[model samples]
Target chain A: MPSLFFYLFTAITLGFGLLVVTARNPVTSALCLAMSFVGLAALFISLDAYFIGTIQILVYAGAVMVLFLFIIMLLDIKAEEGKKPNLPAVIGGVVLAVILALQIVTVSSSYSLGKTPLKNAPLSLNKAAETSVLPTISNDLKVGTLPDAKLMGLTLFKQYGFHLQAIGLLLLVGTVGVVVLSKREKGGQDA
Target chain B: MITLNHYLIVSALLFSLGMAGVIARRNILIIYMCLEMMLSAANLTLVAFSRFRVVEGLPDYAAQSLVFFTITVAAAEVAVGLAIIVALYRSKQSVEVESVTKLQG
Candidate 1:
Protein backbone atom coordinates (compact mmCIF):
# COMPACT_ATOMS: atom_id res chain seq x y z
CA MET A 1 0.00 0.00 0.00
CA PRO A 2 1.17 3.48 -0.83
CA SER A 3 1.98 5.82 2.04
CA LEU A 4 -0.54 8.32 0.66
CA PHE A 5 -3.42 5.90 0.79
CA PHE A 6 -2.36 4.72 4.21
CA TYR A 7 -2.40 8.26 5.52
CA LEU A 8 -5.73 8.93 3.81
CA PHE A 9 -7.39 6.00 5.50
CA THR A 10 -5.71 6.80 8.78
CA ALA A 11 -7.12 10.30 8.64
CA ILE A 12 -10.55 8.96 7.78
CA THR A 13 -10.46 6.50 10.68
CA LEU A 14 -9.12 8.82 13.35
CA GLY A 15 -10.96 11.91 12.15
CA PHE A 16 -14.34 10.24 12.25
CA GLY A 17 -13.35 8.54 15.45
CA LEU A 18 -12.83 11.95 16.97
CA LEU A 19 -16.24 12.99 15.71
CA VAL A 20 -17.71 9.93 17.31
CA VAL A 21 -16.34 11.16 20.60
CA THR A 22 -17.42 14.75 20.29
CA ALA A 23 -20.73 14.52 18.45
CA ARG A 24 -23.56 15.56 20.78
CA ASN A 25 -26.23 13.47 19.16
CA PRO A 26 -26.11 9.70 19.53
CA VAL A 27 -27.24 9.11 15.95
CA THR A 28 -24.46 11.29 14.59
CA SER A 29 -21.96 9.50 16.77
CA ALA A 30 -23.20 6.13 15.49
CA LEU A 31 -22.98 7.22 11.84
CA CYS A 32 -19.49 8.62 12.33
CA LEU A 33 -18.50 5.39 13.98
CA ALA A 34 -19.75 3.49 10.93
CA MET A 35 -17.61 5.70 8.69
CA SER A 36 -14.65 5.10 10.99
CA PHE A 37 -15.20 1.34 10.74
CA VAL A 38 -15.29 1.56 6.96
CA GLY A 39 -11.98 3.35 7.01
CA LEU A 40 -10.65 0.75 9.39
CA ALA A 41 -11.75 -1.98 6.99
CA ALA A 42 -9.76 -0.20 4.31
CA LEU A 43 -6.73 -0.29 6.55
CA PHE A 44 -7.23 -4.03 7.04
CA ILE A 45 -7.33 -4.53 3.27
CA SER A 46 -4.14 -2.55 2.95
CA LEU A 47 -2.56 -5.05 5.32
CA ASP A 48 -3.72 -7.77 2.86
CA ALA A 49 -6.22 -9.22 5.33
CA TYR A 50 -8.94 -9.11 2.73
CA PHE A 51 -11.38 -11.38 4.50
CA ILE A 52 -11.09 -9.49 7.75
CA GLY A 53 -11.65 -6.24 5.91
CA THR A 54 -14.76 -7.55 4.13
CA ILE A 55 -16.33 -8.82 7.32
CA GLN A 56 -15.39 -5.66 9.20
CA ILE A 57 -17.66 -3.82 6.81
CA LEU A 58 -20.36 -6.47 6.74
CA VAL A 59 -20.65 -7.11 10.46
CA TYR A 60 -19.79 -3.67 11.80
CA ALA A 61 -20.82 -1.12 9.21
CA GLY A 62 -23.81 -3.15 8.05
CA ALA A 63 -25.33 -5.18 10.86
CA VAL A 64 -23.94 -3.46 13.95
CA MET A 65 -24.60 0.14 12.96
CA VAL A 66 -28.13 -0.73 11.88
CA LEU A 67 -28.71 -2.21 15.32
CA PHE A 68 -27.40 0.94 16.98
CA LEU A 69 -29.64 3.11 14.82
CA PHE A 70 -32.66 0.99 15.55
CA ILE A 71 -32.11 1.31 19.27
CA ILE A 72 -31.40 5.03 19.11
CA MET A 73 -34.62 5.72 17.19
CA LEU A 74 -36.60 3.33 19.32
CA LEU A 75 -35.48 4.95 22.53
CA ASP A 76 -36.22 8.40 21.09
CA ILE A 77 -33.15 9.90 22.69
CA LYS A 78 -32.91 13.63 22.12
CA ALA A 79 -29.64 15.48 21.66
CA GLU A 80 -28.06 16.19 25.02
CA GLU A 81 -28.80 19.86 24.51
CA GLY A 82 -28.52 22.40 27.33
CA LYS A 83 -27.07 19.80 29.66
CA LYS A 84 -24.04 21.00 31.57
CA PRO A 85 -21.04 18.91 30.62
CA ASN A 86 -19.25 17.06 33.35
CA LEU A 87 -16.16 19.22 33.52
CA PRO A 88 -13.95 16.99 35.64
CA ALA A 89 -14.66 13.83 33.68
CA VAL A 90 -14.15 15.61 30.36
CA ILE A 91 -10.77 16.98 31.40
CA GLY A 92 -9.74 13.69 32.90
CA GLY A 93 -10.72 11.75 29.80
CA VAL A 94 -8.82 14.03 27.42
CA VAL A 95 -5.74 13.97 29.60
CA LEU A 96 -5.87 10.22 29.98
CA ALA A 97 -6.24 9.73 26.25
CA VAL A 98 -3.31 11.99 25.51
CA ILE A 99 -1.14 10.22 28.01
CA LEU A 100 -1.98 6.81 26.57
CA ALA A 101 -1.33 7.96 23.02
CA LEU A 102 2.02 9.42 23.95
CA GLN A 103 3.01 6.28 25.82
CA ILE A 104 2.26 4.07 22.80
CA VAL A 105 4.11 6.42 20.47
CA THR A 106 7.23 6.34 22.63
CA VAL A 107 7.20 2.60 23.07
CA SER A 108 6.50 1.79 19.42
CA SER A 109 9.13 4.25 18.21
CA SER A 110 11.80 2.50 20.24
CA TYR A 111 10.62 -0.99 19.29
CA SER A 112 12.90 -2.42 16.64
CA LEU A 113 10.49 -4.73 14.80
CA GLY A 114 7.84 -2.07 14.09
CA LYS A 115 10.29 -0.21 11.89
CA THR A 116 10.05 -2.78 9.10
CA PRO A 117 8.09 -1.73 6.02
CA LEU A 118 5.55 -3.92 4.20
CA LYS A 119 7.80 -4.25 1.18
CA ASN A 120 10.50 -5.91 3.30
CA ALA A 121 7.99 -8.54 4.42
CA PRO A 122 6.28 -9.37 1.15
CA LEU A 123 4.14 -12.55 1.05
CA SER A 124 6.01 -15.50 -0.46
CA LEU A 125 3.22 -17.26 -2.35
CA ASN A 126 5.38 -19.81 -4.13
CA LYS A 127 7.16 -20.74 -0.94
CA ALA A 128 3.85 -21.03 0.91
CA ALA A 129 2.36 -23.19 -1.89
CA GLU A 130 5.28 -25.60 -1.61
CA THR A 131 4.33 -26.45 1.98
CA SER A 132 0.57 -25.94 1.99
CA VAL A 133 -1.51 -29.07 2.70
CA LEU A 134 -4.67 -27.80 1.06
CA PRO A 135 -4.62 -28.16 -2.68
CA THR A 136 -6.92 -25.18 -3.24
CA ILE A 137 -4.73 -22.93 -1.15
CA SER A 138 -1.63 -24.23 -2.88
CA ASN A 139 -3.20 -23.78 -6.26
CA ASP A 140 -4.30 -20.26 -5.58
CA LEU A 141 -0.86 -19.40 -4.25
CA LYS A 142 0.79 -21.13 -7.21
CA VAL A 143 -1.32 -18.99 -9.54
CA GLY A 144 0.18 -15.80 -8.01
CA THR A 145 -3.05 -14.98 -6.11
CA LEU A 146 -3.60 -14.50 -2.41
CA PRO A 147 -6.59 -16.54 -1.41
CA ASP A 148 -7.14 -14.63 1.82
CA ALA A 149 -10.60 -15.94 2.70
CA LYS A 150 -9.69 -19.52 1.90
CA LEU A 151 -6.59 -19.32 4.05
CA MET A 152 -8.58 -17.79 6.91
CA GLY A 153 -11.28 -20.46 6.64
CA LEU A 154 -8.64 -23.16 6.67
CA THR A 155 -6.97 -21.66 9.70
CA LEU A 156 -10.24 -21.37 11.61
CA PHE A 157 -11.45 -24.89 10.91
CA LYS A 158 -8.09 -26.65 10.97
CA GLN A 159 -6.57 -24.96 13.97
CA TYR A 160 -9.32 -23.18 15.88
CA GLY A 161 -12.33 -25.34 15.19
CA PHE A 162 -13.24 -25.69 18.83
CA HIS A 163 -13.03 -21.96 19.38
CA LEU A 164 -15.38 -21.44 16.44
CA GLN A 165 -17.95 -23.73 17.99
CA ALA A 166 -17.59 -21.88 21.28
CA ILE A 167 -18.29 -18.62 19.51
CA GLY A 168 -21.41 -20.15 17.95
CA LEU A 169 -22.57 -21.19 21.40
CA LEU A 170 -21.88 -17.74 22.76
CA LEU A 171 -23.98 -16.21 20.01
CA LEU A 172 -26.84 -18.57 20.78
CA VAL A 173 -26.68 -17.69 24.45
CA GLY A 174 -26.56 -13.99 23.61
CA THR A 175 -29.70 -14.32 21.46
CA VAL A 176 -31.58 -16.10 24.21
CA GLY A 177 -30.37 -13.62 26.78
CA VAL A 178 -31.50 -10.66 24.71
CA VAL A 179 -34.95 -12.12 24.17
CA VAL A 180 -35.33 -12.85 27.86
CA LEU A 181 -34.02 -9.45 28.94
CA SER A 182 -36.26 -7.47 26.64
CA LYS A 183 -39.39 -9.53 27.12
CA ARG A 184 -42.19 -7.66 28.93
CA GLU A 185 -43.06 -9.09 32.30
CA LYS A 186 -46.47 -10.48 33.11
CA GLY A 187 -48.76 -7.93 34.82
CA GLY A 188 -46.24 -5.24 33.68
CA GLN A 189 -44.26 -5.50 36.90
CA ASP A 190 -40.81 -3.91 36.77
CA ALA A 191 -37.89 -6.12 37.66
CA MET B 1 6.95 3.88 3.00
CA ILE B 2 4.36 2.85 5.53
CA THR B 3 6.07 0.95 8.27
CA LEU B 4 4.36 -1.24 10.83
CA ASN B 5 4.83 1.63 13.25
CA HIS B 6 2.54 3.79 11.12
CA TYR B 7 -0.28 1.35 11.55
CA LEU B 8 0.55 0.98 15.18
CA ILE B 9 0.41 4.71 15.73
CA VAL B 10 -2.92 4.92 13.95
CA SER B 11 -4.33 2.12 16.01
CA ALA B 12 -3.09 3.66 19.20
CA LEU B 13 -4.64 6.99 18.37
CA LEU B 14 -7.90 5.32 17.44
CA PHE B 15 -7.92 3.45 20.72
CA SER B 16 -7.25 6.62 22.64
CA LEU B 17 -10.14 8.33 20.89
CA GLY B 18 -12.44 5.52 21.86
CA MET B 19 -11.28 5.61 25.42
CA ALA B 20 -11.93 9.31 25.60
CA GLY B 21 -15.40 8.85 24.17
CA VAL B 22 -16.21 6.18 26.68
CA ILE B 23 -15.16 8.35 29.57
CA ALA B 24 -16.51 11.67 28.39
CA ARG B 25 -19.77 10.80 26.67
CA ARG B 26 -22.82 10.63 28.91
CA ASN B 27 -25.00 8.85 26.39
CA ILE B 28 -24.81 5.10 27.01
CA LEU B 29 -25.29 4.23 23.34
CA ILE B 30 -22.42 6.47 22.21
CA ILE B 31 -20.29 4.95 24.91
CA TYR B 32 -21.09 1.54 23.44
CA MET B 33 -20.09 2.83 20.00
CA CYS B 34 -16.81 4.02 21.45
CA LEU B 35 -16.30 0.60 22.94
CA GLU B 36 -16.73 -0.89 19.47
CA MET B 37 -14.20 1.59 18.11
CA MET B 38 -11.70 0.45 20.70
CA LEU B 39 -12.33 -3.16 19.70
CA SER B 40 -11.77 -2.30 16.04
CA ALA B 41 -8.52 -0.57 16.96
CA ALA B 42 -7.36 -3.75 18.60
CA ASN B 43 -8.39 -5.65 15.47
CA LEU B 44 -6.32 -3.25 13.40
CA THR B 45 -3.28 -3.94 15.54
CA LEU B 46 -3.73 -7.70 15.23
CA VAL B 47 -4.11 -7.55 11.45
CA ALA B 48 -1.10 -5.26 11.18
CA PHE B 49 1.02 -7.70 13.13
CA SER B 50 -0.29 -10.59 11.07
CA ARG B 51 0.87 -8.81 7.93
CA PHE B 52 4.25 -7.75 9.23
CA ARG B 53 5.16 -11.08 10.82
CA VAL B 54 5.49 -13.71 8.13
CA VAL B 55 5.10 -17.36 9.07
CA GLU B 56 5.87 -20.25 6.77
CA GLY B 57 6.48 -17.76 3.96
CA LEU B 58 2.97 -16.40 4.37
CA PRO B 59 1.21 -13.89 6.57
CA ASP B 60 0.11 -15.67 9.76
CA TYR B 61 -3.53 -16.69 9.57
CA ALA B 62 -3.87 -17.19 13.31
CA ALA B 63 -4.26 -13.53 14.11
CA GLN B 64 -6.88 -13.04 11.42
CA SER B 65 -8.85 -15.96 12.79
CA LEU B 66 -8.76 -14.35 16.22
CA VAL B 67 -10.04 -11.13 14.67
CA PHE B 68 -12.93 -13.08 13.12
CA PHE B 69 -13.89 -14.46 16.50
CA THR B 70 -13.57 -11.05 18.06
CA ILE B 71 -16.01 -9.62 15.53
CA THR B 72 -18.49 -12.40 16.11
CA VAL B 73 -18.31 -11.94 19.86
CA ALA B 74 -18.61 -8.18 19.53
CA ALA B 75 -21.76 -8.57 17.43
CA ALA B 76 -23.34 -10.83 19.99
CA GLU B 77 -22.31 -8.47 22.76
CA VAL B 78 -23.92 -5.54 21.00
CA ALA B 79 -27.18 -7.43 20.64
CA VAL B 80 -27.30 -8.27 24.31
CA GLY B 81 -26.09 -4.84 25.36
CA LEU B 82 -28.73 -3.07 23.32
CA ALA B 83 -31.38 -5.30 24.76
CA ILE B 84 -30.21 -4.44 28.22
CA ILE B 85 -30.22 -0.77 27.34
CA VAL B 86 -33.80 -1.09 26.08
CA ALA B 87 -34.79 -2.64 29.34
CA LEU B 88 -33.03 0.14 31.21
CA TYR B 89 -34.83 2.68 29.10
CA ARG B 90 -38.17 1.07 29.71
CA SER B 91 -37.62 1.14 33.42
CA LYS B 92 -35.85 4.50 33.82
CA GLN B 93 -37.16 6.33 30.74
CA SER B 94 -33.73 7.79 29.93
CA VAL B 95 -30.50 6.86 28.13
CA GLU B 96 -28.31 9.39 29.92
CA VAL B 97 -25.56 8.02 32.14
CA GLU B 98 -26.74 10.22 34.98
CA SER B 99 -30.04 8.39 35.10
CA VAL B 100 -28.50 5.10 36.22
CA THR B 101 -27.44 6.24 39.67
CA LYS B 102 -28.89 3.36 41.60
CA LEU B 103 -25.51 1.78 42.09
CA GLN B 104 -23.57 4.99 42.57
CA GLY B 105 -23.53 4.83 46.33
Candidate 2:
Protein backbone atom coordinates (compact mmCIF):
# COMPACT_ATOMS: atom_id res chain seq x y z
CA MET A 1 0.00 0.00 0.00
CA PRO A 2 2.73 2.44 0.94
CA SER A 3 4.64 1.24 -2.07
CA LEU A 4 1.60 2.10 -4.16
CA PHE A 5 1.73 5.60 -2.76
CA PHE A 6 5.44 5.69 -3.47
CA TYR A 7 5.09 4.67 -7.11
CA LEU A 8 2.12 6.95 -7.65
CA PHE A 9 3.69 10.06 -6.22
CA THR A 10 6.99 9.36 -7.85
CA ALA A 11 5.38 9.04 -11.27
CA ILE A 12 3.30 12.14 -10.78
CA THR A 13 6.25 14.18 -9.53
CA LEU A 14 8.56 13.00 -12.26
CA GLY A 15 5.94 13.51 -14.96
CA PHE A 16 5.22 17.09 -14.04
CA GLY A 17 8.92 17.54 -13.50
CA LEU A 18 9.48 16.58 -17.12
CA LEU A 19 6.81 18.99 -18.20
CA VAL A 20 8.53 21.72 -16.23
CA VAL A 21 11.72 21.16 -18.15
CA THR A 22 10.22 20.70 -21.57
CA ALA A 23 7.56 23.39 -21.49
CA ARG A 24 8.31 26.32 -23.74
CA ASN A 25 6.58 29.22 -22.00
CA PRO A 26 7.98 30.17 -18.63
CA VAL A 27 4.53 30.79 -17.15
CA THR A 28 3.27 27.35 -18.06
CA SER A 29 6.51 25.85 -16.86
CA ALA A 30 6.21 27.54 -13.49
CA LEU A 31 2.70 26.20 -13.09
CA CYS A 32 3.90 22.72 -13.96
CA LEU A 33 6.63 23.12 -11.38
CA ALA A 34 4.03 24.01 -8.75
CA MET A 35 2.24 20.77 -9.55
CA SER A 36 5.51 18.89 -9.23
CA PHE A 37 6.17 20.37 -5.80
CA VAL A 38 2.74 19.23 -4.62
CA GLY A 39 3.46 15.73 -5.83
CA LEU A 40 6.84 15.73 -4.11
CA ALA A 41 5.17 16.72 -0.86
CA ALA A 42 2.84 13.78 -1.24
CA LEU A 43 5.83 11.50 -1.75
CA PHE A 44 7.28 12.78 1.52
CA ILE A 45 3.95 12.01 3.21
CA SER A 46 4.16 8.35 2.16
CA LEU A 47 7.46 8.17 4.03
CA ASP A 48 5.49 9.01 7.23
CA ALA A 49 7.08 12.44 7.40
CA TYR A 50 3.85 14.45 7.47
CA PHE A 51 5.46 17.63 8.78
CA ILE A 52 7.90 17.87 5.91
CA GLY A 53 5.16 17.23 3.36
CA THR A 54 2.85 19.90 4.79
CA ILE A 55 5.67 22.43 4.99
CA GLN A 56 6.69 21.50 1.45
CA ILE A 57 3.25 22.42 0.19
CA LEU A 58 2.83 25.55 2.27
CA VAL A 59 6.30 26.99 1.78
CA TYR A 60 7.25 25.71 -1.64
CA ALA A 61 4.06 25.31 -3.63
CA GLY A 62 2.07 28.00 -1.89
CA ALA A 63 4.41 30.88 -1.05
CA VAL A 64 7.46 30.30 -3.20
CA MET A 65 5.54 29.50 -6.37
CA VAL A 66 3.33 32.51 -5.90
CA LEU A 67 6.46 34.64 -5.71
CA PHE A 68 7.73 33.05 -8.90
CA LEU A 69 4.49 33.74 -10.70
CA PHE A 70 4.43 37.26 -9.28
CA ILE A 71 7.85 37.84 -10.76
CA ILE A 72 6.67 36.35 -14.01
CA MET A 73 3.80 38.82 -14.02
CA LEU A 74 6.04 41.71 -13.07
CA LEU A 75 8.56 40.84 -15.73
CA ASP A 76 5.74 40.48 -18.23
CA ILE A 77 7.95 38.10 -20.21
CA LYS A 78 5.72 36.94 -23.05
CA ALA A 79 8.04 34.91 -25.22
CA GLU A 80 11.70 34.25 -24.46
CA GLU A 81 13.86 36.71 -26.38
CA GLY A 82 17.10 35.94 -28.21
CA LYS A 83 17.06 32.36 -26.93
CA LYS A 84 19.98 31.14 -28.98
CA PRO A 85 19.90 27.34 -29.02
CA ASN A 86 22.69 26.92 -26.51
CA LEU A 87 25.75 26.44 -28.74
CA PRO A 88 27.61 25.85 -25.50
CA ALA A 89 25.17 22.93 -25.13
CA VAL A 90 27.88 20.54 -26.38
CA ILE A 91 30.06 21.33 -23.39
CA GLY A 92 27.18 20.63 -20.99
CA GLY A 93 26.07 17.61 -22.98
CA VAL A 94 29.51 16.04 -22.84
CA VAL A 95 29.67 16.67 -19.12
CA LEU A 96 26.27 15.08 -18.58
CA ALA A 97 27.15 12.06 -20.74
CA VAL A 98 30.33 11.50 -18.79
CA ILE A 99 28.62 11.81 -15.43
CA LEU A 100 25.78 9.50 -16.40
CA ALA A 101 28.17 6.96 -17.94
CA LEU A 102 30.17 6.98 -14.73
CA GLN A 103 27.02 6.41 -12.69
CA ILE A 104 25.86 3.57 -14.90
CA VAL A 105 29.27 1.94 -14.74
CA THR A 106 29.39 2.25 -10.95
CA VAL A 107 25.93 0.81 -10.41
CA SER A 108 26.47 -2.00 -12.91
CA SER A 109 29.79 -2.95 -11.36
CA SER A 110 28.35 -2.82 -7.85
CA TYR A 111 25.41 -4.99 -8.86
CA SER A 112 27.60 -7.63 -10.49
CA LEU A 113 29.98 -7.60 -7.52
CA GLY A 114 27.06 -8.34 -5.16
CA LYS A 115 26.82 -7.85 -1.42
CA THR A 116 28.06 -10.75 0.66
CA PRO A 117 25.41 -11.82 3.10
CA LEU A 118 26.41 -13.17 6.49
CA LYS A 119 27.09 -16.90 6.39
CA ASN A 120 24.54 -18.98 8.38
CA ALA A 121 23.04 -15.81 9.84
CA PRO A 122 19.86 -16.20 11.89
CA LEU A 123 16.67 -15.05 10.20
CA SER A 124 15.76 -13.19 13.40
CA LEU A 125 18.59 -10.70 12.92
CA ASN A 126 17.46 -7.07 12.64
CA LYS A 127 18.64 -5.11 9.59
CA ALA A 128 18.01 -1.66 11.07
CA ALA A 129 19.59 -2.20 14.49
CA GLU A 130 22.66 -0.12 13.76
CA THR A 131 20.68 2.93 12.64
CA SER A 132 18.58 3.39 15.78
CA VAL A 133 21.65 3.79 17.96
CA LEU A 134 21.96 7.52 17.29
CA PRO A 135 18.87 8.28 19.35
CA THR A 136 20.74 6.89 22.31
CA ILE A 137 23.26 9.69 21.90
CA SER A 138 20.57 12.34 22.44
CA ASN A 139 19.28 10.77 25.68
CA ASP A 140 22.81 10.65 27.11
CA LEU A 141 23.23 14.36 26.34
CA LYS A 142 22.58 15.53 29.92
CA VAL A 143 19.82 13.17 31.01
CA GLY A 144 16.04 13.59 30.54
CA THR A 145 16.36 16.91 28.75
CA LEU A 146 16.69 15.40 25.28
CA PRO A 147 13.79 13.94 23.42
CA ASP A 148 14.36 13.26 19.72
CA ALA A 149 12.32 16.14 18.35
CA LYS A 150 13.37 18.36 21.23
CA LEU A 151 17.00 17.59 20.64
CA MET A 152 16.63 18.39 16.97
CA GLY A 153 14.76 21.60 17.76
CA LEU A 154 17.26 22.66 20.38
CA THR A 155 20.11 21.97 18.02
CA LEU A 156 18.49 24.06 15.33
CA PHE A 157 17.73 26.96 17.63
CA LYS A 158 20.99 26.89 19.58
CA GLN A 159 23.57 25.86 17.03
CA TYR A 160 22.05 26.76 13.69
CA GLY A 161 19.90 29.71 14.75
CA PHE A 162 22.31 32.26 13.34
CA HIS A 163 22.15 30.72 9.89
CA LEU A 164 18.37 30.82 10.01
CA GLN A 165 18.46 34.46 11.06
CA ALA A 166 20.98 35.18 8.35
CA ILE A 167 18.56 33.90 5.72
CA GLY A 168 15.87 36.25 6.96
CA LEU A 169 18.29 39.18 6.92
CA LEU A 170 19.38 38.25 3.44
CA LEU A 171 15.79 38.21 2.23
CA LEU A 172 15.21 41.66 3.71
CA VAL A 173 18.34 43.00 2.08
CA GLY A 174 17.45 41.43 -1.23
CA THR A 175 14.03 43.01 -1.15
CA VAL A 176 15.59 46.42 -0.54
CA GLY A 177 18.20 45.86 -3.18
CA VAL A 178 15.65 44.89 -5.81
CA VAL A 179 13.51 47.92 -5.07
CA VAL A 180 16.53 50.22 -5.23
CA LEU A 181 17.91 48.62 -8.37
CA SER A 182 14.65 48.79 -10.25
CA LYS A 183 13.95 52.40 -9.41
CA ARG A 184 15.42 54.41 -12.27
CA GLU A 185 16.67 58.05 -12.45
CA LYS A 186 14.33 60.76 -13.72
CA GLY A 187 16.89 62.76 -15.73
CA GLY A 188 18.98 61.74 -18.74
CA GLN A 189 21.06 58.93 -17.32
CA ASP A 190 19.73 57.22 -20.43
CA ALA A 191 21.97 56.13 -23.30
CA MET B 1 18.83 -7.68 -9.56
CA ILE B 2 16.46 -4.89 -8.66
CA THR B 3 17.87 -3.67 -5.40
CA LEU B 4 18.75 -0.45 -3.55
CA ASN B 5 21.27 0.20 -6.27
CA HIS B 6 18.48 0.34 -8.82
CA TYR B 7 16.79 3.03 -6.79
CA LEU B 8 20.03 4.98 -6.57
CA ILE B 9 20.41 4.83 -10.34
CA VAL B 10 16.92 6.22 -10.83
CA SER B 11 17.74 8.99 -8.38
CA ALA B 12 20.88 9.73 -10.32
CA LEU B 13 18.93 9.93 -13.54
CA LEU B 14 16.45 12.34 -12.04
CA PHE B 15 19.31 14.45 -10.68
CA SER B 16 21.14 14.59 -13.98
CA LEU B 17 17.99 15.53 -15.83
CA GLY B 18 17.44 18.37 -13.40
CA MET B 19 21.00 19.54 -13.82
CA ALA B 20 20.68 19.43 -17.58
CA GLY B 21 17.50 21.46 -17.44
CA VAL B 22 19.30 24.15 -15.46
CA ILE B 23 22.21 24.22 -17.82
CA ALA B 24 20.37 24.00 -21.10
CA ARG B 25 17.31 26.14 -20.51
CA ARG B 26 17.48 29.84 -21.31
CA ASN B 27 14.76 30.90 -18.89
CA ILE B 28 15.80 31.88 -15.39
CA LEU B 29 12.51 30.75 -13.84
CA ILE B 30 12.90 27.31 -15.33
CA ILE B 31 16.47 27.16 -14.09
CA TYR B 32 15.32 27.83 -10.53
CA MET B 33 12.61 25.19 -10.79
CA CYS B 34 15.15 22.70 -12.11
CA LEU B 35 17.32 23.48 -9.11
CA GLU B 36 14.39 22.56 -6.87
CA MET B 37 13.93 19.32 -8.76
CA MET B 38 17.61 18.49 -8.35
CA LEU B 39 17.36 18.99 -4.64
CA SER B 40 14.28 16.79 -4.52
CA ALA B 41 16.18 14.00 -6.24
CA ALA B 42 18.92 14.23 -3.62
CA ASN B 43 16.35 14.14 -0.80
CA LEU B 44 14.79 11.04 -2.32
CA THR B 45 18.18 9.34 -2.24
CA LEU B 46 18.66 10.26 1.42
CA VAL B 47 15.29 8.86 2.39
CA ALA B 48 15.99 5.68 0.49
CA PHE B 49 19.29 5.25 2.31
CA SER B 50 17.69 5.87 5.68
CA ARG B 51 14.91 3.38 5.00
CA PHE B 52 17.35 0.71 3.98
CA ARG B 53 20.03 1.33 6.61
CA VAL B 54 18.21 2.34 9.78
CA VAL B 55 16.93 -0.35 12.12
CA GLU B 56 13.44 0.26 13.37
CA GLY B 57 12.70 1.94 16.77
CA LEU B 58 15.88 3.89 17.51
CA PRO B 59 14.57 7.36 16.62
CA ASP B 60 17.29 8.21 14.11
CA TYR B 61 15.98 11.13 12.07
CA ALA B 62 19.02 12.75 10.57
CA ALA B 63 17.83 12.44 6.99
CA GLN B 64 14.47 13.92 7.92
CA SER B 65 16.16 16.81 9.72
CA LEU B 66 18.44 17.52 6.78
CA VAL B 67 15.44 17.54 4.44
CA PHE B 68 13.78 20.21 6.56
CA PHE B 69 16.81 22.47 6.18
CA THR B 70 16.92 21.80 2.45
CA ILE B 71 13.32 22.94 2.11
CA THR B 72 14.04 26.09 4.12
CA VAL B 73 16.97 27.04 1.96
CA ALA B 74 14.90 26.41 -1.16
CA ALA B 75 12.23 28.80 0.09
CA ALA B 76 14.81 31.52 0.72
CA GLU B 77 16.29 30.95 -2.72
CA VAL B 78 12.96 31.38 -4.41
CA ALA B 79 12.34 34.66 -2.60
CA VAL B 80 15.68 36.16 -3.59
CA GLY B 81 15.71 34.66 -7.07
CA LEU B 82 12.27 36.02 -7.91
CA ALA B 83 13.19 39.47 -6.61
CA ILE B 84 16.28 39.56 -8.77
CA ILE B 85 14.36 38.35 -11.78
CA VAL B 86 11.72 41.03 -11.33
CA ALA B 87 14.38 43.72 -11.01
CA LEU B 88 16.24 42.47 -14.01
CA TYR B 89 13.07 42.52 -16.09
CA ARG B 90 12.34 46.10 -15.09
CA SER B 91 15.83 47.26 -16.12
CA LYS B 92 15.95 45.28 -19.34
CA GLN B 93 13.00 44.48 -21.58
CA SER B 94 13.86 40.81 -21.96
CA VAL B 95 14.84 38.15 -19.40
CA GLU B 96 17.28 36.31 -21.67
CA VAL B 97 20.82 36.06 -20.26
CA GLU B 98 22.45 37.10 -23.54
CA SER B 99 20.76 40.50 -23.61
CA VAL B 100 22.14 41.53 -20.23
CA THR B 101 25.78 41.26 -21.29
CA LYS B 102 26.35 44.97 -21.92
CA LEU B 103 24.55 47.54 -19.74
CA GLN B 104 23.23 49.42 -22.80
CA GLY B 105 26.75 50.02 -24.12
TM-score of 1: 0.98
- Regions of model 2 farther than 4 Å from truth: A80-84, A87-105, A108-191, B1-7, B53-59, B103-105
Model 1 complex DockQ against the native: 0.82
Q: Residue by residue across B1-105, what tens digits does model 1's lDDT show?
A: 999999999999999999998998889999999999999999999999999999988898999999999999999999999999999999998888999999887
lDDT of 2 by residue, B1-105 (tens): 234454455567667767878877777778888888888778766655543443343223566667767777777666667766766666666677666777676
- In candidate 1, which residue pairs get closer than 3 Å at backbone N, Cα or C atoms, i.e. clash? none
Q: What lDDT score belongs to each candidate, Candidate 1 first?
A: 0.94, 0.65
lDDT of 1 by residue, A42-71 (tens): 999999999999999999999999999999
TM-score of each: 0.98, 0.71
- Global lDDT of model 1: 0.94
Give fnat, all candidates.
0.88, 0.29
Candidate 2 CAPRI classification by DockQ: acceptable
Considering just the first chain, candidate 2 attains a TM-score of 0.63
Residue A89 CA error for candidate 1 (Å)?
0.8
Task: Give the best candidate by lDDT.
Answer: 1
How displaced is residue B61 in candidate 2, in Å? 2.5
